[model samples]
Target: MAEPRFSRFAAIDWSGAQGHRHKGIAVAVCATGDAAPTLVAPPGASAWSRDDVLDWLLCQDTSTLIGLDLSPAFPFVDQDGYFPGAPDSPLDARALWKMVDDASAADPHLAVSSLLTDPEIRRHFRQHRDCGDLFPGGAGRMRVCEHGQRTMGLSPTSCFNLVGAAQVGKSSLTGMRVLHRLAGRLPVWPFDPLPPHGPAIVEIYTTIAARAAGIRKGLSKMRDAVSLDTALANLGSQPHRPLARYDDHATDAILTAAWLRANADRAELWRPQAMTPHIARTEGWTFGVS
Candidate 1:
């Protein structure tokens, strides 16, 4: 079979913080024949808003495959839904996305603080507190894919754990809002059907791309030009200039974009053994996690 090919590849390092602009958000893009990915900023803006990214995505002309570094859904299978015992929890991933979008309707830039403020929603998470006793038994809060990532040495965190620097719950929640808005415009992999031609977005773990680029674990970020170049080279690309910045968000976006460009044709990534129908509908799987 012919391999999948896209005209352009992009990756976004998303942030869930409340604001009109965020430094934590970074975007990188590379063309099919490009030697390296380049960090992209909004045309007239220094920083990118979640809305800015959505607008840019909608304006794209070519068939693009964008990788987003956030969890697409929470641990629904194991927990029986977002709100475990609550009778009104969402029925599926689409429903969950709508719930998050609806709850954060009043927040600027799609910030999910309002959803976190809810008594029921806040109870399942460990936010800004080290208390493990809040959750009953404090286990199974992570999804099956998260455990799979851990076994692969990626140090995946639970989407339900909203606290700590390593937690991705906030980004995921906010991303779901974006996903809900992009429902018909762009097809999300494994959840929505792949279109005949156009843009599609997929969930990505930047650490997985970093590992594929021969980066060692325990290193917090890649800032040096040599290391960045080497990592890009491993993914069939090289740095166009010195990527000496200390921002892990920028580096991750650059690396993952190149990785997507280099490896998007791999059949194994599209088909995972654990991506059952229920899991895809309730708890989405990471694109590269098999």
Candidate 2:
């Protein structure tokens, strides 16, 4: 296949903590070049709500490859079904996305707390407060791409493990609601076909971008300008301007956006060797993980 020619690249460091505004959420975007990425200020607030991200993303007008820093589905092939033994298990990722969205429809701000805490499904997750009764032990089950990520020496937490600092369970769960909404507007990679034009979303683990940028594991979180620019330079991107404050969330989005711009055209990234059709329909591959 030929290289994808996106006019722009965007990286969103998402959050799933329950609230109207999330300090963990960060969005950075850059054009189709080596220019530095800039963090987008939240609309009408100090922090961005989940709804704000949905609105902002839908409004973007460009052939952009949007990278969401969250998993869009749970472990499927590894366990045969997301909620194993449950007769109502989704047939595929789309059904899972709808199941998540439907569970949280009445909730405010696109939060998936209801779904996480639901009696019938809580047993499958290792939530912050308690490990579910049927929870798989030790970071829970891994997606196929996650196992590949492991071979590359990067750690990927399970969407079923919501505890600890590295936990992405909440974000992954909440992101499905966003993906469900963006289904038609923004076709998610692997699960949805690449459109002839317009924006599309893909799962991104910022750590992968950091690794490619020459930043070592466990030290990929840049909390200073010098460190951030150093990593950006490793990716052949221009140094970013000073931020209001130095933190991992903002730096992650900024650095990963530049990384996407630098690497988006690689044809091989769109086709990982281990990515079979079944895996694509279930636990979609991360964009840069091949």
Candidate 3:
């Protein structure tokens, strides 16, 4: 198969925080021939709002391959929908996105905590507060992609597990709201048909890219200049500015951008064996994961 060629590569480290501007959110970009990826600040702002990121993405002229570090959908295969017993559970991924968008309609920043009001939906998740009776038991509750990630030796938290620092559920929920708005503007990979031109967004896990770049497992974040530079070099990216602090958000964006560029031509990534039609339309597979 011929390699998919894009004019530019970019990645966004997303956040679920309820605010106009988020410090945790970061954007990184690299051109076809650029030496290395550079952090991008939101225009005239110290930090980026979810809206700002969307606006920036829409304004780009080149055909860009964008990676978003968040789950585009939830675990629907096991229960057939996010809320199994509920009367009106979303039938598919697009339906679920609409549900989230509707719930968060008043919240312009895409805050998703309000969805917890539904008792059935809240039962499946473990919030930061000790919700002893609410924790859903066993790995069967996890999505197929989460299970697949563990099988590949990458520890992936369930998108339903909304508690703790490592949980991705909140980010994923908020991200769905953004996706609903970008429906026509950005075609998400494996969900919407890939556009012949313009930008295409895909779900990404930075740890997958980090491991491919030779970073050891168990290290929480990439600190120091040597390790960061080495990981970038492994992706065939030129040396970049040293990290001033141990920041996973910044490092993930930088490394994932290079990883996307390095692996853009790999035919296998575009078509993973496990990416069945149901998975694509509902659960949504992570890019680069087979």
Candidate 4:
């Protein structure tokens, strides 16, 4: 068995919907043992704001490993660059995060509304009515790990396509801003080498965690205690306490946190076969994508 690398694992079900507080957002955390993950209530009886997540993350001890259900970057590999043909595009992930944060400096609640409005940046995405002229059709550009997800019978959304219910573009843009803020304070995997000890962040797809927990594909969303507990049990986690409401957002975070606890020390997960150094620096990968 792999030795434990982190004492606590946390998962954040992030949202990119235009709002200060989002009902779709949820957070769950668990420890090294088999105890079930606990849903963290948003402060003030309201839904969790993206900024609230950043604040909570900053407060977590160094022993925690945070996983977020948001893409840290747009595709760069297929097109040979993040913004093909666009001059002076960010050279690396940190620069991309800086550009995103700078573009939305005026946006409140850690949102990146202003970033989407930027003409230069807007040319790469497919927003509501306007399909970017540069937008590559037929599923858009995909990162290496995204392709792996498809190979494993999981469909991963391209961050460049901003339409549809599963649009990851907004979430990614907004999360990039938070990532920029956390740059010096926390080390995001691949962007910075995984430190020997300290709090670190990794991009996580809740579906990946769900599938690993033995939840069938396309049916990973748990809407009740029984389904949630069954998935938890598959990961050697104890049964979760009864929740007043069992929605996808809550269940996803809870299950992913437990999954993170179980898999953090896996050697192959940290070092994927297809991930080259250039890919890691250009497009950070999703955890468990190997």
Each candidate: what lDDT?
A: 0.83, 0.88, 0.82, 0.89
**Model 3 Cα lDDT, one tens digit per residue, 118-169:** 6666776777773525356553267777788888899888787776688888
Per-model TM values vs. the true structure: 0.93, 0.96, 0.93, 0.97
lDDT of 4 by residue, 28-108 (tens): 998889999998999886799998899988887668899999999878888788887777888888899998898789988
Those runs of model 1 whose alpha carbons end farther than 4 Å from true positions after fitting are 1-3, 129-140, 243-246
| Model 1 agreement with the true structure over 1-290: per-residue lDDT tens digits | 66466889999999987688888999999988747888886668888999999888788768899999999998877767778766589988889999999998988888888888787777777777533333543443777788889889878777777767887988999999999998877889888866778888899999989999898888737877677788888888956565446488888898899989988888788888888888888888887888
Model 2: per-residue Cα lDDT at residue 96: 97
Candidate 2 lDDT tens digits, 1-290: 76457988899999988878988999999986678999899998999899999999999878998999999888899879999976698989999999999988888888887787688798888876788888979878999999999999988988889888889988898899998898777778989877778888888999988888899867888999999999999999989989998888999999999988888878788889999999999999998878
How many steric overlaps does candidate 4 have? 0
Error of 3 at 193 (Å): 2.2
* All-Cα superposition RMSD per candidate: 2.0, 1.6, 2.0, 1.3
